[model samples]
Structures are given as C-alpha cells and as structure tokens.
Target: MEKNTILEQLRAAKAAHINWVQRAKMLISGFKMEEDAIPVNSTQCKFGQWFYSDAQRLNGLRNNPLDCMSEIEKLHFELHDIYLNIYKIYYDLEPQGFFSKLFGKKKKITDDSVKLAKEYFASMEEVSKKLVNEINLMERRIVALPDTDLETL
Candidate 1:
C-alpha cells in the first residue's frame, strides 16, 4: 500500500478508537452513577447489572478494531493489555442472565463489586489516554518518515 493510503487508514482507525473510548467512558460513568443511586440489594439493581453486562460486552467488542490497527502497525499497544484486564474484571463481575435470575441464582452486588467497578472505570480511562498517546506517536513517526522511505514501504 502507498504511504499516504496507509497513513489515512491509520488516522481513521485512530479516530474510531478515540470515539469508542469516549463512548465507553460515558457508559461507565453513567452506569456508575446509576448503580450508586440504587440500593445494592434492591430488585431494581438487577437492571443495573444487566446494563453492566452489556457495557462489558460492548467494551470487549471495541477492543478488536484497535487490535487490528495495532497488528497492522506492528505495535503492541498498552491499551490492548489494559482492555484484557478490563475484560477479566468484567468476567469476574458477570451478571446473571434471565434464566439465572429466574432460577434465583442472581449474584449479590456488594460494596466490593462497586469498588471494583470504579477501578475498572479508572483502568479504562488510563487505556484511553495511553491509546491517544500511542496514536499520536504513530502519526508523528509516519509524518516524519522521508518520502523515499515511505515509498519503499
């Protein structure tokens, strides 16, 4: 591929990733606030759990596009590792599905779970910042490359 074409693709990926991270942050923040508003033991809390599960799934899905970009650029970004960590935390906090709730197997959302959620949100924010930095560095490198070297690639 031509250098300019590759750079354009990278820029697009960067924009998409940034937007994804921003949306994720908004979801997490909204969920956190909502979760805090409801009593942990209330039946209504189940809805929050469901929302969290969906958010986790969404976050997991978002990681793939960024990973593709990372692979294409031959760079292993810290965001990828952080996303894995976030996934693990979500897995640990996985909410009971409809059948599980119907069967009375709902997991209790304790204060510890709330703390963990906050930690997860912080980790996600960190990943977002790191990803922005990494993308900026990648863009700088691409821009700095000589025309001769760019053409060779």
Candidate 2:
C-alpha cells in the first residue's frame, strides 16, 4: 500500500477508536447518572455481553493465518491493534462498569478517557486529512501516466 493510503487507513481507524471512546463515556455516564441505566430487563442491556461479543469477533478474525490474509484483513488487524493500544493508553480513565460502582462513590473513568482520546483524535485528524489530500494528489499523477498498449506485450 502507498504511504498516504496507509496514513489514511490509520486516520480512519483512529477516528473510529476515538468515536468508541466517546460512546463508552456516554454509556458509563448513563450508567452512573441513571438509577438503572443497565438493568437486567434484557440480555441486550448487559454491557459485558456487548464487550465480549466485540472482543470475540476481533480476536477471531485477527488470529487468522498470515498467508491467507488479504489487504482488508491486514487493515482490520492494523485498526484493531490501534484501538487496543489506545484503549490501554486511556484504560485507567474508565471506571469499572459495575452497577455498584456506577451508583456509588466511584468516579467515571470512561468519561475521562473519552476526554483525553478526543484531544488525541483531534490532533491525529489533522494528519489524516493531510494524508488524504496527498493520496488524492498521487492518484492524479497515476491517472496522468501514459497508457500502455497491452497488445504490444
């Protein structure tokens, strides 16, 4: 892949990671402010279920044989790795997602992580936009190249 394309991919993946960080914060806040934001009313309301599901899907696809991996697969792995790394970077900011903690004296770590992640993303977003512009310029150059005659080969 081209350097600009790779940068674009990184930007997109980072944006997504940043988005999730915000979402996690919102969920955590809801869990905290509400008396029962995540009640046992249904399996869908269980945060653990969604976390496990996401983690499972990510791990399963990421562990595939290297030889069999396609560009998209590699991108997925790269994106997943970026997210995992960012999560660790701000993981300490998130509070334990437990009902007792949410309603009790515990502060929300998710909110804190999201705040920091947003700043990180904002800076990276500028780089991503620049990369996209670079990729577009490169594509224009490729398009301007002379067409080869396949029949002459």
Candidate 3:
C-alpha cells in the first residue's frame, strides 16, 4: 500500500482504539453499578451477559481497521492478540445459564471476575495507547522519508 494510504488507515485504527477505550470504561462503570444494584432475591442478573454482548460489539468495531493493517506491521498482530485476550477474559466471565436462571440462583460476581475485568480494561487501555503511539511514530517516519525513499517504499 502507499505510505499515505497506510497512514490514513493507521489514523482510522487510532480512532477506533480511542473509541474502544471509551466503551471499555463505560462497560466498567456499568458493571460496577450493576453489581451494586443486584437484589438479594434476584437470580440470573443479566449484567455479566449484557457486558459480554456489549464487549463483543466493541470488539467488532476494530475489525475493519485491524483487517486493513493485518500485513502492515507486527504491531498489528500484537494488538490482535491483545484484543483476543480481552475477549477471552470476558467470555470466561459470561453469566451461567439454564438451571441457574430457572432455579432463581443468583449469578454472583466473584472477586476473580472483578479482578479479571479490571485487568482486562487496563490492558485494553494500555494497548490503545500503544496503538496511538505507533500510529504517531509511523506518521512521523513517513513524513521524514525522502521522496525517492517514499516512492521505493
């Protein structure tokens, strides 16, 4: 791809990463509120499951930009791995079903779940920052390259 095109894609990816970070923060806040609001008599709180769905949607938002950069740099691969890990963590914490719902057994949020969510959000924020930095560095490098070198690139 041309350097300009690559830079444009990187900018888009940076934007997506920023948006994802915001969504992740919102999810964290929502999760906390939901955890706090769970009634003693309630079973099968939908918060965890809702979070999973929302997280999946947020994950999807980056797919287009990420796909565009798949072959551009190793950093893209690292970002992909980080995204997958986040999804895996969320998946593991997905609410239990069937019997618990039927029996009115509360799907209590364990300390482990809270810890994992906090860690995952932090990792996601870090990764997003890294992506933005990488994009900025790439833009600077591209700007610094001579016309001949740019043509060759």
Cα RMSD (angstroms) for every candidate in the order listed: 12.1, 12.7, 11.8
In order, the Cα lDDT scores of the candidates are: 0.46, 0.39, 0.46
Q: What is the TM-score of each predicted model, taking all chains together? A: 0.48, 0.33, 0.47
Candidate 3: tens digits of C-alpha lDDT, residues 48-93: 2322332123224322232322222344444445545444443334
| 14-85: candidate 1 lDDT, tens digit per residue | 665655455445534543322223222212233223323321222233222323334322222344444444
**What lDDT score goes with residue 107 in model 3?**
41
lDDT of 3 at 59: 26
Candidate 2 versus the native: TM-score? 0.33
Query: Which window of 10 residues has the lowest lDDT sum in candidate 1?
Result: 34-43
Best-to-worst order by TM-score is: 1, 3, 2
